[model samples]
Target: MTGDGWNAAVRRRLGLGRLLALGGPEDGVWITERAATSVLGAVAAALPGLAVTSLRLAPADPGAAAEPAVPPPPSALPPGPLRVSAEVVALGGRPLPELVAALREALFTAARERLGLVVSDVDVQVTALLDDLPDPPNGGPPPGPTDQPASATATAALTTPGVARLTAELGPPVQTAEGHVRVEVATAPPHHPLEVARAVRTAVGRAAPDADSVAVLITWAG
Candidate 1:
């Protein structure tokens, strides 16, 4: 049998055991709940027959706020919101099974960590695989916001204690030519939107008292 065939066998053996142990569909447990365990199980099942090194979960830092910094004088970085990527690596043989397993695990981890994410499914593409010699380890670029200018008001507003945290935590500000900026603000535990809005209005007035208005866009995170 081909290496691919062996890989499939390994996955099936491991998956069968997991399937047996898991409760039926009626239990309402999500398939994702078992994702990590399934992948690790598959790895263990194939280890004795295959030479495996180690499994690692490496997530890059989210980096500092993207809005505060000025853009570079030159060079090319995509413009817009921040970009983050997650990929799986196998330090073993050319097995489609293991590749799929690792990719799924990586995707699952990303979904849990990244907020406001919508994932259709984890699509695994086997970029590389080696034989007797260990597979080459993979590396991905560090993550940060794309090239964008800091809002004149946002930069200034963040200097304060309460307003600073709210502005920073919310995603990029939505600009309007009307000279009015609308955003959702919250306080410790859970503060009413009206209170947060009042606080923001006060902060903005303090920063730029001349500003026309600071409207609260919505109650929750926008």
Candidate 2:
């Protein structure tokens, strides 16, 4: 294959992993798998002797999932319960199962309480046991605004509660197309991502009353 063709394929594979559902039907929020997994890696870094070597988030069961209340943008994942699959390497300290259990709990707690991700299940695999701790996992790049014309509703989205800033890759932070609004934001902590997204939706709705749907994509959260 041509180098450019290979590069394009790689980009598609890596370009902002899968979108994972963040909240219920009305919330209309999704988070990139890369962003969520990066945060989850940090959660493991904080735990004693546990390192999340890798993680991925995907729809729990697409066939059994109910249709989203509002149709999602073609690029975003359909709203549904999600499952986390992780591989971990542990330092010799605790029972393997016990350590795995703790790792699972940490992922669940962080995903739900801190990020408001609709993570219904966590599957952890202990890949290795180490004699000494490995270097802490590094987070992926933080979300930043994409290069596109900022819509008039940008201010409204930024002014919403819990929104820290806007971030995107291919389009403006705030985008409205065909009565649908797609907002990509970096949310501040102490407020769940879902809550922040919902507020953004409300604010955007007020700003563009004609908008029929809003999809919030959270790029970062403390």
Candidate 3:
């Protein structure tokens, strides 16, 4: 199917809601199904050696209508809790159950804290186990500058103390600009945001000193 057609089908199957207005109508706070999905996707993508193949959100009541019945009144409220499900491909040798459990926790925490939405359930399906390839013989003749993958940048960020995990939305973790390196991360809580940012900068610097500069973003503190 075409992209738009596929999205329409997903909307029909999942019964997604439109942008939800929160608090007084004049307050102007709002959240969209797309936003919620983005948050959840980020959480899942952050897991080391795991790749999210698909993510779906379903209404708490499966039979609910696909579209809202009427325009919300002035005092708009959030929608009911949702059910989240995902398909993933994992690399490395970590136990599947352990990874799923961690993904569930991260999803729950992120949904609650970021969107104030309650996720009633998180179902993770491991569709594939990727083999870990052995390193090139003799260290692969050292990578040339700019040959580094974003995953390497993410690994450098993960090395920082107290960093729980990088957000999956940060695809490839490293962005290069004008000879500088930029790294973005979302960390689990218990550590201050500023401290985590500092740690990430230091770690990235050590890992890639050739980088003209290292920029770090703490997308999540808790």
Score every model by TM-score. Answer: 0.29, 0.87, 0.43
lDDT of 3 at 5: 76
Ranking by lDDT: 2, 3, 1
Task: Summarize candidate 2's per-residue lDDT along 119-204 as a digit string, tens digits.
Answer: 78999988888898778766755655445345657878887888888876435677778778888888876677778888888888
Judged by whole-model lDDT over C-alpha atoms, candidate 3 comes out at 0.55
Off by over 4 Å in 3: 1-30, 62-70, 73-78, 132-222
TM value for model 1: 0.29
Badly placed stretches (over 4 Å) of model 2 are 1-13, 145-151
Residue 159 of candidate 1: its Cα lDDT?
36
lDDT of each: 0.33, 0.77, 0.55
lDDT tens readout by residue for model 3, 154-216: 678876876665543223446666656656454454554445665676777688777766655
Model 1 C-alpha lDDT per residue in residues 53-167, reported as the tens digit of each score: 3332211222421221112111112112222232333446456586566555554544333211223344444344444444433322211232333655555434333432332
Winning candidate number (TM-score): 2
Error in Å for residue 20 of model 1: 39
